[model samples]
Target: MYPTDFIERINSLKKELETKTPLRIEDEKRLKKKLRLEFNYNSNHLEGNTLTYGQTELLLLHDKSTGDVKLSDIEEMKAHDVALSQIEEMARENERPLTESFICELNKLILVRPFWKEATDFNGNTTRKKIEIGKYKSTPNSVRLRNGEIHEYASVEATPAMMTDLIDWYRENEPSMHPVQLAALFHYKFVCIHPFDDGNGRVSRLIMNYILLKNNYPPIIIKSADKENYLTSLQKADTGKQLAIIEYVEQQAIWSLELSLKAANGEDLEEKGDIDKEIELLKREKLSKTTNFKSKNTVYDLINHLHDDLWNSISLQLLKFKDFYEKANNEIILNHELDQKLSLTIRDNFNLFKILAPAIKIAIKDNHLDSTDNFYDIKNLLWIWSYSSNKTATKDIEETIEMNLQLEFKFYEISLVNNKYELERNGSLISTTIIYQSKNDYDTRITSESINNILKSISKQLIKQIKEEE
Candidate 1:
C-alpha cells in the first residue's frame, strides 16, 4: 500500500535505526517506559479518557495520582497499563503467530472488568446489553457519522471469520510489506471490521503497535490532539485512498525515530525550568549538550561520594557474611546511570548540591541469598537513594533495600536535615515525611559523624532483618 517515496523513507530510517539497533539496554528501557506513557496517554485521550499527561506519568511511574477525574478513568488508565504489559509479554514469550485468542486477551486486559450498556436493539428499542470481555461481540455494532449516515461493521456471524482472515492476511503479507504500511493498513482494516463492541479502536491501536514492535520498529503514537486529522486520514483510506494514511503513519514513525535518537543521546526527555522570568537573580547557566549542564559535574561528583559512602556502609553490614561474596564470589557491578532530574532553576537559584536518586544493584549469585522457607530465587538486590537540595521544599531523604525475595525494609526519615534524631521503637521510624523549615537549633548542625552513625545503625538493622527473614 506504500508509495515509492514512502517506501524509500521508511527503508532509509529502518536502515539508520538498524545501525543503532543495539542501543544501550538501560537507555532502551528508559525510552521504552517513556514511549509507553506517551502512547497510553495519547491513545486513551483519543478515546475520550480525561487523564492528563502529567497525571498519567505520575500514576504509571510512581503509582501516585492527583486529579479531579472519574474512577472509571483511573481504572481504565490502570487497565491500559496492564494491557500494554500483556502485549509486551506476548511479544516476548509467545512464539506462535498472532491469533484470535491473543487479540481477545488484549481486549480483556484493557477492560479488566466489563459493565453492561444500553444500546438500541434490532427491534429499535433500547435494551441492556452485556458487553462481553475477551469475547467476540454477539450483538450488532455500528457507528453513526457526523452527516447522519451509518457505518456498520461485520455482522456478529462474520466477525469470527473476518478476524481469522485478518490474521491470515497479516501473516501472508507481513514478510513483504513495510512495517509502517503493514501497521497502518491493519489498523484501518481492523477498525472497519469492528470485531469488539466497546474497545475496537483501542485494540486496533494496540494491534498496530504490536505489529510495529514485533518487526523491531518503534511504536507510533497517533496523538489525540490530532484527532481530526487521524479521522480524516482514516476516511481517506475508506475511500480507497490508502497512501494518505500510509504517509501519515510514515511521518509518525519518523517522529518516533527522532524522539528515540534524541533520548538515546541523553537529551532532556522533557522540558525543564521556568523560563517565565526574563531576568533571574543569577545568570542562566550555559550548559554543554553532552552532560546537559555544568552543574551535572557537581551532581555526579556528589553522587560518586554518596555511592562510596553507601557502599562502605553496606560492606561493613555484610562483613560477617564475607563468605557470601567471597566463597560465593558474587561480583558487584556498578552502573553509573544516575537518574538525575536536570533542573536549571535549581542550579541557577542556589548551589545545587544533591541530585535525584539513582541506584546500585548487587548480583546475588546462585541461591546465595535464598532461604528454604521463602524459596525465593533472589536474583539481585538494589539500594535506591539520593541526597537533598531542598530547592522546592524540604526534601525527604529515604533509602530502600529491595531484593527478589520481596523483602523491603528501610529506615525512612532518619535525616541530617535538621530534624529530631530520637530513636524510637523502630529506631526513629518516620512513616510519613514532615515538611517545614529547619528549626533554628537543628539547622546546619548535622555533621558527617552523625550521618555515619545513622548509616551504621541502619546497616546493622538491615543486616539483622535480612538474617531474621532468612
Candidate 2:
C-alpha cells in the first residue's frame, strides 16, 4: 500500500513536470500542499501495515484486562508521534529553493537535533554517556554498533575554525564534482569529522537528500532494512577501500530520478535509459566535459548540462516570440509591441544566464565531461525559470533582464558575505556591500565612486551583523 502511494505520487510529479511554463507563487503553494498530502498518506499507510496482531489484541484487551499493557503502548505511540512531528516540523522549516549554503545549514540542524538523547546501545546505555559503554572490552568507543559489542565512545569536539574550513572547502570544490559524487564525498567527510557526538549517520543521510532535493531531485530514504549494507558502504568509503559510497549514491540518485520521472508522467513506473552508459557516451562525445572541467568532472558535467538546457529553453522562448510576430495577420503595432516585450524578456534571461555561468563553470572545473545526458527536458527548464521569475514579468523585457542579472549579483553578494564571516571566525576580518541610490531631479548625476562607497558601507554593515550574530 505504501509503495502504491509512492508510485502514485511519482506519477503525479511526472505530469507536473510537463508544464514548462514558469512557476508562479500559486504553483509553488500547490506543489507544497500536494507533497504534504502524499507524505502523510504514505506515512499513515506504513504505520497501519506495521501494526502487529498482538498490538491489535492488546488494544482490545485493554478494554477487558486489568494490565497496564494498553497504557504502555499508548505512551510509546505518543513518543513516536512526537519524534516524527519534530522531524516533520524541521523538514518544513528548512524547505526553500535549493542553495549550497542552505543545504549545509540543514545538515548541521539534522546533526544537532535532540533525538540523539533517545538513541540507546545494546547494554541500554544511551548515547548521552560520556565514558565508553564497556571499558573492560576491546571494542572501540563509538555511537555505532561494531560486531556484537557495544563500545563506550568519547565525542570529538570541533572548533569553529574546523567547521569554517569544511564549508570553505565545500564551496571551493563542490561546483567541480558530480552532484552525486560531491554529495557522497560530503557525506563521508562529514561523518568522518564526526562533528557531533552522535546521530552522524542520520544527519549525513539527511544532508545527502537535501542536496538532491535542492537540485530538483527526489529524496532517498535509506530504509532501516538496508542498515547493514548502508553501514558497510560507509565503512568502505571511510577506509578508502573502494568507491562503494559513490556507487551507492549514484544508485540512489538513479532511483530518485526514475521516481521523479514516473511521477511527472502520471505512470506507475517505467524503464530508464542506462545512466552510466549515457554518461560514458557523453564523455566520448566530449559533451559532458565543460571548458573548466579539471578535478570534479562528473559534477561539472551535470551542472553544465543543466545550464545549457536552461539556456536552450530560453532560446526557444525567443524563437516562439519571433514566430508570433512573423505569423501575425493583423494588429501590426500590437504585434510589434509584444515582440519588443518578449525581446526584453529574452535579454533579461540572457543576463541571468550570464550571472549563473560562473557558478556552472566553477562546478565543472574538477570533472571533465565524458558524456552528456539530457537530465533536464525543455519543459523542466521552463518550469525552473517560471518558478524563479515568481510569475511577474518585468515592465520591459530589458528590465526583466536587468532583474535577473541583479539576482545573480545578489547571490554572489551573499556568498561573499558568508565567506567573510567564515574567515572572520579564523581571526580575519573583511567587509563589502552594494547599494543603489536615486535622486528625484531630472538631470541628476550619479558617479561610480558613489556607488563604490555605498557598496563598501553595505559590506561593512553586513560584516557587523554577522559579528553580532556570533
Candidate 3:
C-alpha cells in the first residue's frame, strides 16, 4: 500500500529543494501554475493546459514506458512545455546549475525525442559500451572510484521494484539519522545503485537533496576544487568506513549553510577588510628592522589592538547573538525579548568593530608606539568580570567581552613582534628590575620588573643565538 503521508512528504521535500536551487523567475511562476493544475485536476478549470485524473495516469505511464524520459515533443506543445518547464523549473529552483554534463544527462532523459546517446567529457570522448560485471553487465557510465577500480554503474536499469524498495527504506530509516549524515548516506546509496545508467549521478544527487530538502536542510555543492576529497569520502563510504563519509558530509553541509546565508545577504565569502591588508603590508615592510629593535613592546601592543578590532568586527557582522541565561552548567534559556536584544547588540558590535579595526591598525602603524596598554588592561578587566561567578551577565554578554579581550591580546602578540618590531634596538638592555626602596637601615623591596626583564632578555638572547648560527 502507498504510504499515507507520501504526497504531503513529497510536497514538503519539493518546496525545500526549490528554495536552495536557483530558478529563472519566469520559470518559477510557470512551475507553480503547472503544479497547481496537476494537483487540482478535478477542478472545473482543468479544461485547458490541465491534466485530468485519467490524463495524469497516462502521462505517468508514458514517462515510465519511455524510461523516465522528460516529455518535450508532444503534439500538445503546451502540455509538453509545462512538463519540461516544470523539470527545468524544479532543477533551477533548487539552485542546481546546469553544467554541460548536467545538460547532457537531461538530454539522455528526453523520452519524447531521443537526441544524444552519450555525454562527452572535456576531451570529447564518449562512453559507448555497457559496463561488464561478474555475471551481469551494467551501464558503462560510471564515476572514477578511489581504489583505482571501476564497476558497472547500477542506476541505469533499476527496476521500479528496486526504486520502490529504496524509497521505502529512506522513509523508514532517514529520520533516525542526523540530517547531514542521512544526506551523505542517501547520496552514496543512490549513486552506488546506479539506477539510471545515463543520468544516475544527477538523479542520485537530486534524490539525496530531496531527502535533505524534506528535512529543511540546505543543499551542498561538492565544488570542483574539492571533488577529489568528495570522491575519497565516497570511496570510504563504499568500504564501510561510514564515519569519514559522515564527517565529510557534515562539514560540507555546514559550509553550504553558511554560504547560503552569505549568498542571501549578497556578501562575498572572500571579502576582507582593508585594515587586514594594511597590517600585512606593514609586517612585510617593517619586520626586518623591528626584529633587532629594542623596546619592541610598543609595536606589539599596537599590533594586538588592531588584530583584535578586525576579528571583533567580522564576528559582529556574521553572528546573531541571542540573549541566553545560564540555568546550570551548559544549559541556557532563550526567549523572544532576549533574542531581539542580543541580535541588536551583536549588529551594533559588529559595525563598531569594522569601523574601529582599520583606524586602530592605521594609528598603530603610523604612531609606532605602545599606546595599547590601556586597551589591553580594559579587556583583561572585562574578561575577568564576564567569567566570574559573581557576575550576572548573559552568555552573549560574556562571550562578547571575552572575544574583545582575546582580540586585543592576539593583535598585540602576532602583529608587533612577528611583523613590525624587534627587541634589540634599545641598547639590547632587555632586563630590568622593578624595585621598591625604603630607608636604608633595614630596607626591603618588591619587584616584578626583574621577571619581565628576564623574559625579554631571554627572548633577545635567543634571537641573537639564531642570528649567530645563521
Report the error of model 3 at residue 70, Å.
21
Ranking by TM-score: 1, 2, 3
Between candidates 2 and 3, the TM-score winner:
2
TM-score of every candidate relative to the true structure: 0.56, 0.35, 0.32
Which of candidates 1 and 2 reaches a greater TM-score? 1
Query: In candidate 2, residue 352 scores what lDDT?
Result: 44
Which pairs clash in model 1?
none
Please provide, for model 1 over 1-470, each residue's C-alpha lDDT reduced to its tens digit, 9 standing for 90 to 100: 45646667677777877887688888788788878987998889999898777667666876654323444566688888888777766666547678899899889888765655669876768767778889999888987776777778899999999999999999999889877899988998899899987888899999888888887778889988788888888888888998878888888888787777766776655534223211221122121112222132222322233344434343344344333221111112222223211111112111111221122211111322222322122112233222222222232322232111111111111222212211233335344222111221100122335435655665565445335332
Overall lDDT per candidate, in order of appearance: 0.59, 0.37, 0.38
lDDT for predicted candidate 3 compared with the true structure:
0.38
Give per-residue CA lDDT, model 2, range 1-470, as digits (tens): 11222334444544465463334555444444333323322222233323232232222223221111222233323333333334444445544433334434443333222211234555766543332211111223354456664433323333234445666776676566555566677777766655544334544555655555544545554544455677788777756754787666666555555554444444443234334433533443353223322223322332343233333233333333331121111000001112221121212433443334344343223232223331111001111222121122321111011011111101111011122212224533333222332321111112224434544544454335434532
Task: Count clashing residue pairs per candidate.
Answer: 0, 42, 27
